[model samples]
Target: MKHGRNLPKLGRKAAHRDAMLSNMAASLILHHRIVTTKQKARALAPFVDRLIQTAKNGKKSLSARRLVARQLYSPEAVEKLFSDTAPKMSDREGGYVRIYRLGRRVGDGAETAVVTIGMATIKVDKKEKKEAKKHKGERPAGYDRTKDEEIFLEKAAAKSKTAEESAEEAKAS
Candidate 1:
Protein backbone atom coordinates (compact mmCIF):
# COMPACT_ATOMS: atom_id res chain seq x y z
CA MET A 1 0.00 0.00 0.00
CA LYS A 2 2.80 2.46 0.98
CA HIS A 3 4.82 2.31 -2.22
CA GLY A 4 7.56 4.72 -3.42
CA ARG A 5 7.91 6.21 0.05
CA ASN A 6 11.19 4.64 1.05
CA LEU A 7 12.74 7.77 2.52
CA PRO A 8 11.64 8.73 6.00
CA LYS A 9 9.94 12.12 5.81
CA LEU A 10 10.48 12.43 9.54
CA GLY A 11 7.05 14.07 9.76
CA ARG A 12 8.49 17.23 8.20
CA LYS A 13 7.80 19.10 4.98
CA ALA A 14 10.43 18.82 2.26
CA ALA A 15 11.93 22.24 3.01
CA HIS A 16 11.97 21.65 6.73
CA ARG A 17 13.59 18.26 6.28
CA ASP A 18 16.33 19.79 4.16
CA ALA A 19 16.86 22.56 6.70
CA MET A 20 16.87 20.10 9.56
CA LEU A 21 19.46 17.94 7.85
CA SER A 22 21.61 20.94 7.03
CA ASN A 23 21.59 22.15 10.59
CA MET A 24 22.17 18.65 11.90
CA ALA A 25 25.11 18.22 9.57
CA ALA A 26 26.65 21.51 10.65
CA SER A 27 26.18 20.82 14.35
CA LEU A 28 27.66 17.37 13.87
CA ILE A 29 30.69 18.91 12.20
CA LEU A 30 31.36 21.72 14.66
CA HIS A 31 30.71 19.82 17.86
CA HIS A 32 31.97 16.45 16.60
CA ARG A 33 28.88 14.96 18.22
CA ILE A 34 25.13 15.27 17.97
CA VAL A 35 21.98 13.51 19.15
CA THR A 36 19.10 12.61 16.91
CA THR A 37 16.74 9.85 15.91
CA LYS A 38 18.38 6.54 15.06
CA GLN A 39 17.17 6.66 11.49
CA LYS A 40 18.44 10.19 10.97
CA ALA A 41 21.78 9.47 12.61
CA ARG A 42 22.25 6.40 10.45
CA ALA A 43 21.46 8.37 7.32
CA LEU A 44 23.68 11.28 8.30
CA ALA A 45 26.89 9.56 9.38
CA PRO A 46 28.40 8.36 6.09
CA PHE A 47 27.23 11.47 4.27
CA VAL A 48 28.72 13.83 6.86
CA ASP A 49 31.92 11.82 7.18
CA ARG A 50 32.49 12.00 3.45
CA LEU A 51 31.90 15.72 3.62
CA ILE A 52 34.48 16.08 6.38
CA GLN A 53 36.95 14.11 4.27
CA THR A 54 36.32 16.51 1.47
CA ALA A 55 36.68 19.50 3.81
CA LYS A 56 40.14 18.32 4.88
CA ASN A 57 41.74 19.06 1.53
CA GLY A 58 39.63 22.16 1.04
CA LYS A 59 40.71 24.28 4.00
CA LYS A 60 42.10 27.14 1.93
CA SER A 61 39.35 27.17 -0.63
CA LEU A 62 36.60 29.67 0.09
CA SER A 63 34.25 28.07 -2.36
CA ALA A 64 34.50 24.73 -0.63
CA ARG A 65 33.53 26.05 2.79
CA ARG A 66 30.82 28.18 1.27
CA LEU A 67 29.39 25.20 -0.51
CA VAL A 68 29.34 23.29 2.74
CA ALA A 69 27.88 26.33 4.49
CA ARG A 70 25.15 26.58 1.92
CA GLN A 71 24.19 23.04 2.63
CA LEU A 72 24.70 23.48 6.41
CA TYR A 73 23.25 27.02 7.01
CA SER A 74 25.77 28.23 9.58
CA PRO A 75 28.92 30.19 8.69
CA GLU A 76 30.82 29.48 11.92
CA ALA A 77 29.95 25.83 11.73
CA VAL A 78 31.34 25.79 8.23
CA GLU A 79 34.53 27.51 9.38
CA LYS A 80 35.22 24.90 12.04
CA LEU A 81 34.08 22.10 9.76
CA PHE A 82 36.85 23.13 7.41
CA SER A 83 39.53 24.19 9.87
CA ASP A 84 39.35 22.16 13.08
CA THR A 85 37.55 18.82 12.69
CA ALA A 86 38.38 18.03 9.08
CA PRO A 87 42.15 18.08 9.44
CA LYS A 88 42.01 15.65 12.33
CA MET A 89 39.79 13.37 10.31
CA SER A 90 42.07 13.62 7.26
CA ASP A 91 44.37 10.88 8.46
CA ARG A 92 41.69 8.25 8.41
CA GLU A 93 40.76 7.00 4.96
CA GLY A 94 37.11 6.65 5.86
CA GLY A 95 34.73 5.63 8.66
CA TYR A 96 35.11 9.04 10.31
CA VAL A 97 31.80 8.96 12.10
CA ARG A 98 30.46 6.74 14.85
CA ILE A 99 26.88 6.09 15.89
CA TYR A 100 26.01 4.87 19.36
CA ARG A 101 22.56 3.62 20.21
CA LEU A 102 21.12 5.50 23.19
CA GLY A 103 17.76 3.77 23.55
CA ARG A 104 14.37 5.49 23.26
CA ARG A 105 13.14 9.05 23.57
CA VAL A 106 10.72 9.87 26.37
CA GLY A 107 8.05 11.83 24.53
CA ASP A 108 7.09 9.44 21.75
CA GLY A 109 9.47 6.58 22.45
CA ALA A 110 11.37 7.23 19.24
CA GLU A 111 14.81 5.60 19.10
CA THR A 112 17.82 7.90 19.52
CA ALA A 113 21.49 7.65 18.69
CA VAL A 114 24.58 9.75 19.29
CA VAL A 115 26.68 10.62 16.28
CA THR A 116 30.38 11.31 16.87
CA ILE A 117 33.55 12.03 14.97
CA GLY A 118 35.82 9.03 14.66
CA MET A 119 39.39 9.21 15.95
CA ALA A 120 42.04 6.55 16.29
CA THR A 121 44.25 6.39 19.34
CA ILE A 122 47.94 6.22 18.64
CA LYS A 123 49.80 4.31 21.32
CA VAL A 124 53.38 4.93 20.33
CA ASP A 125 55.39 4.35 23.50
CA LYS A 126 58.16 6.89 22.85
CA LYS A 127 55.77 9.72 22.07
CA GLU A 128 53.71 9.04 25.20
CA LYS A 129 56.90 8.81 27.29
CA LYS A 130 58.12 12.15 25.93
CA GLU A 131 54.81 13.81 26.70
CA ALA A 132 54.82 12.32 30.20
CA LYS A 133 58.34 13.54 30.91
CA LYS A 134 57.47 17.05 29.72
CA HIS A 135 54.47 17.15 32.05
CA LYS A 136 56.45 16.04 35.14
CA GLY A 137 58.79 19.06 35.32
CA GLU A 138 60.60 21.74 33.36
CA ARG A 139 63.90 20.63 31.88
CA PRO A 140 66.85 22.91 31.02
CA ALA A 141 68.29 23.49 27.58
CA GLY A 142 70.27 20.48 26.33
CA TYR A 143 68.91 18.59 29.33
CA ASP A 144 70.49 15.26 30.15
CA ARG A 145 68.81 13.00 32.67
CA THR A 146 71.13 9.95 32.41
CA LYS A 147 74.00 12.28 33.24
CA ASP A 148 72.19 14.02 36.11
CA GLU A 149 70.93 10.84 37.79
CA GLU A 150 74.56 10.52 38.75
CA ILE A 151 74.13 13.53 41.09
CA PHE A 152 73.39 10.87 43.73
CA LEU A 153 76.96 9.56 43.22
CA GLU A 154 78.23 11.57 46.23
CA LYS A 155 75.55 10.11 48.54
CA ALA A 156 76.22 6.57 47.30
CA ALA A 157 79.95 7.03 48.01
CA ALA A 158 79.25 8.18 51.60
CA LYS A 159 76.95 5.24 52.24
CA SER A 160 79.54 2.81 50.85
CA LYS A 161 82.25 4.12 53.14
CA THR A 162 80.00 3.91 56.21
CA ALA A 163 79.05 0.33 55.35
CA GLU A 164 82.73 -0.62 54.82
CA GLU A 165 83.85 0.85 58.21
CA SER A 166 81.02 -0.83 60.06
CA ALA A 167 81.84 -4.19 58.44
CA GLU A 168 85.52 -3.86 59.40
CA GLU A 169 84.70 -3.23 63.09
CA ALA A 170 82.31 -6.23 63.05
CA LYS A 171 85.08 -8.43 61.61
CA ALA A 172 87.36 -7.35 64.51
CA SER A 173 90.39 -7.56 62.21
Candidate 2:
Protein backbone atom coordinates (compact mmCIF):
# COMPACT_ATOMS: atom_id res chain seq x y z
CA MET A 1 0.00 0.00 0.00
CA LYS A 2 2.94 2.31 0.11
CA HIS A 3 2.39 3.90 -3.29
CA GLY A 4 2.57 7.46 -4.68
CA ARG A 5 4.78 8.55 -1.78
CA ASN A 6 7.80 10.38 -3.23
CA LEU A 7 9.14 12.94 -0.79
CA PRO A 8 11.11 12.21 2.39
CA LYS A 9 9.47 14.11 5.23
CA LEU A 10 12.60 14.20 7.39
CA GLY A 11 10.36 14.79 10.45
CA ARG A 12 9.89 18.40 9.45
CA LYS A 13 7.06 20.48 8.06
CA ALA A 14 7.06 21.70 4.46
CA ALA A 15 8.48 25.18 5.06
CA HIS A 16 11.16 23.90 7.43
CA ARG A 17 12.17 21.13 5.05
CA ASP A 18 12.45 23.60 2.18
CA ALA A 19 14.59 25.95 4.24
CA MET A 20 16.79 23.13 5.52
CA LEU A 21 17.30 21.71 2.04
CA SER A 22 18.08 25.14 0.63
CA ASN A 23 20.64 25.81 3.32
CA MET A 24 22.16 22.38 2.92
CA ALA A 25 22.42 22.92 -0.82
CA ALA A 26 24.19 26.22 -0.20
CA SER A 27 26.55 24.68 2.34
CA LEU A 28 27.43 21.85 -0.02
CA ILE A 29 28.26 24.40 -2.71
CA LEU A 30 30.43 26.44 -0.35
CA HIS A 31 32.36 23.60 1.34
CA HIS A 32 32.39 21.01 -1.51
CA ARG A 33 31.27 18.40 1.04
CA ILE A 34 29.11 17.95 4.10
CA VAL A 35 28.35 15.29 6.76
CA THR A 36 24.70 14.41 7.15
CA THR A 37 22.39 11.49 7.71
CA LYS A 38 22.02 8.99 4.88
CA GLN A 39 18.38 9.76 4.26
CA LYS A 40 19.04 13.46 4.23
CA ALA A 41 21.98 12.99 1.93
CA ARG A 42 19.89 10.94 -0.45
CA ALA A 43 17.26 13.64 -0.56
CA LEU A 44 19.82 16.39 -0.91
CA ALA A 45 21.90 14.76 -3.64
CA PRO A 46 19.32 15.12 -6.40
CA PHE A 47 18.38 18.59 -5.22
CA VAL A 48 21.96 19.80 -5.34
CA ASP A 49 22.65 18.04 -8.61
CA ARG A 50 19.77 19.82 -10.22
CA LEU A 51 21.13 23.13 -8.98
CA ILE A 52 24.56 22.34 -10.39
CA GLN A 53 22.96 21.27 -13.62
CA THR A 54 21.03 24.49 -13.77
CA ALA A 55 24.13 26.50 -13.22
CA LYS A 56 25.96 24.43 -15.78
CA ASN A 57 23.19 24.57 -18.30
CA GLY A 58 22.95 28.32 -18.13
CA LYS A 59 26.20 29.79 -16.94
CA LYS A 60 25.86 33.01 -18.94
CA SER A 61 22.22 33.84 -18.66
CA LEU A 62 21.19 36.36 -16.04
CA SER A 63 17.80 34.67 -15.68
CA ALA A 64 19.43 31.32 -15.00
CA ARG A 65 21.69 32.88 -12.40
CA ARG A 66 18.72 34.54 -10.81
CA LEU A 67 16.80 31.28 -10.79
CA VAL A 68 19.62 29.43 -9.03
CA ALA A 69 20.12 32.38 -6.70
CA ARG A 70 16.47 32.16 -5.71
CA GLN A 71 16.98 28.56 -4.62
CA LEU A 72 20.28 29.16 -2.80
CA TYR A 73 19.98 32.36 -0.80
CA SER A 74 23.64 32.75 0.19
CA PRO A 75 25.60 35.19 -1.93
CA GLU A 76 28.90 33.32 -1.64
CA ALA A 77 27.28 30.03 -2.48
CA VAL A 78 25.68 31.56 -5.55
CA GLU A 79 28.97 33.10 -6.54
CA LYS A 80 30.80 29.80 -6.19
CA LEU A 81 28.02 28.00 -7.95
CA PHE A 82 28.28 30.35 -10.92
CA SER A 83 32.04 30.77 -10.94
CA ASP A 84 33.77 27.64 -9.70
CA THR A 85 31.44 24.70 -9.23
CA ALA A 86 29.34 25.25 -12.30
CA PRO A 87 32.28 25.56 -14.67
CA LYS A 88 34.18 22.76 -12.98
CA MET A 89 31.22 20.46 -13.48
CA SER A 90 30.18 21.72 -16.89
CA ASP A 91 31.97 18.91 -18.66
CA ARG A 92 29.82 16.32 -16.96
CA GLU A 93 26.20 15.83 -17.88
CA GLY A 94 24.79 14.99 -14.46
CA GLY A 95 25.34 13.01 -11.22
CA TYR A 96 27.18 15.86 -9.55
CA VAL A 97 26.96 14.55 -6.00
CA ARG A 98 28.30 11.39 -4.35
CA ILE A 99 27.23 9.96 -0.99
CA TYR A 100 29.26 7.57 1.14
CA ARG A 101 27.84 5.88 4.25
CA LEU A 102 29.94 6.28 7.42
CA GLY A 103 28.18 3.85 9.75
CA ARG A 104 25.71 4.90 12.45
CA ARG A 105 25.63 7.85 14.77
CA VAL A 106 26.77 7.23 18.35
CA GLY A 107 23.88 8.77 20.26
CA ASP A 108 20.84 7.89 18.11
CA GLY A 109 22.31 5.10 15.99
CA ALA A 110 21.07 6.83 12.86
CA GLU A 111 22.93 6.02 9.67
CA THR A 112 25.32 8.84 8.76
CA ALA A 113 27.06 9.65 5.52
CA VAL A 114 29.21 12.22 3.76
CA VAL A 115 28.07 13.91 0.56
CA THR A 116 30.67 15.51 -1.62
CA ILE A 117 30.84 16.97 -5.06
CA GLY A 118 32.26 14.30 -7.35
CA MET A 119 35.27 16.38 -8.36
CA ALA A 120 36.57 17.26 -4.92
CA THR A 121 40.22 16.33 -4.48
CA ILE A 122 42.86 16.30 -1.75
CA LYS A 123 46.63 16.09 -1.89
CA VAL A 124 47.93 12.53 -1.39
CA ASP A 125 51.39 11.17 -0.70
CA LYS A 126 53.07 9.35 -3.57
CA LYS A 127 54.19 6.47 -1.33
CA GLU A 128 50.63 5.83 -0.07
CA LYS A 129 48.98 6.04 -3.47
CA LYS A 130 48.24 2.32 -3.54
CA GLU A 131 46.93 2.28 0.01
CA ALA A 132 44.93 5.43 -0.55
CA LYS A 133 43.45 3.95 -3.70
CA LYS A 134 42.51 0.84 -1.77
CA HIS A 135 40.66 2.85 0.85
CA LYS A 136 39.24 5.77 -1.07
CA GLY A 137 36.37 6.08 1.35
CA GLU A 138 38.73 7.28 4.07
CA ARG A 139 40.59 10.56 4.08
CA PRO A 140 43.17 11.60 1.48
CA ALA A 141 46.70 10.23 1.71
CA GLY A 142 48.30 13.35 3.19
CA TYR A 143 46.30 13.11 6.41
CA ASP A 144 48.55 13.79 9.42
CA ARG A 145 47.92 11.41 12.30
CA THR A 146 50.59 13.23 14.36
CA LYS A 147 48.24 16.18 14.80
CA ASP A 148 45.77 14.03 16.70
CA GLU A 149 44.79 14.94 20.24
CA GLU A 150 46.13 11.63 21.65
CA ILE A 151 49.69 12.83 20.98
CA PHE A 152 48.93 16.14 22.68
CA LEU A 153 47.46 14.30 25.63
CA GLU A 154 50.57 12.20 26.01
CA LYS A 155 52.83 15.25 25.93
CA ALA A 156 50.62 17.04 28.46
CA ALA A 157 50.67 14.03 30.77
CA ALA A 158 54.47 13.87 30.66
CA LYS A 159 54.70 17.58 31.43
CA SER A 160 52.26 17.24 34.31
CA LYS A 161 54.20 14.31 35.80
CA THR A 162 57.46 16.25 35.59
CA ALA A 163 55.83 19.28 37.20
CA GLU A 164 54.42 17.12 40.03
CA GLU A 165 57.83 15.55 40.69
CA SER A 166 59.53 18.98 40.72
CA ALA A 167 56.88 20.29 43.12
CA GLU A 168 57.41 17.27 45.40
CA GLU A 169 61.20 17.88 45.41
CA ALA A 170 60.64 21.59 46.21
CA LYS A 171 58.32 20.66 49.11
CA ALA A 172 60.93 18.21 50.45
CA SER A 173 63.68 20.88 50.22
Model 1: per-residue lDDT, tens digit, 1-173? 76784557777887887788888888887777888999998778766876776687677797777667668778888777777788777667888888889999999999999888786322379988998888777776799987766877877988999999999999996
Which ten contiguous residues of candidate 2 have the minimum total lDDT?
118-127
- What lDDT, from 0 to 1, does candidate 1 have? 0.79
Q: Which residue ranges in model 1 land beyond 4 Å of their true spot? A: 1-7, 120-173
Which candidate wins on lDDT?
2
TM-scores for every candidate against the unseen true structure: 0.61, 0.70
Q: What is the C-alpha RMSD of each candidate to the true structure, in Å?
A: 14.4, 10.4
CA-lDDT, candidates in order: 0.79, 0.90
In angstroms, the error of model 2 at 74 is 0.4
- Per-residue C-alpha lDDT of model 2 across residues 12-45, encoded as one tens digit per residue: 9978998999999999999998999999999999
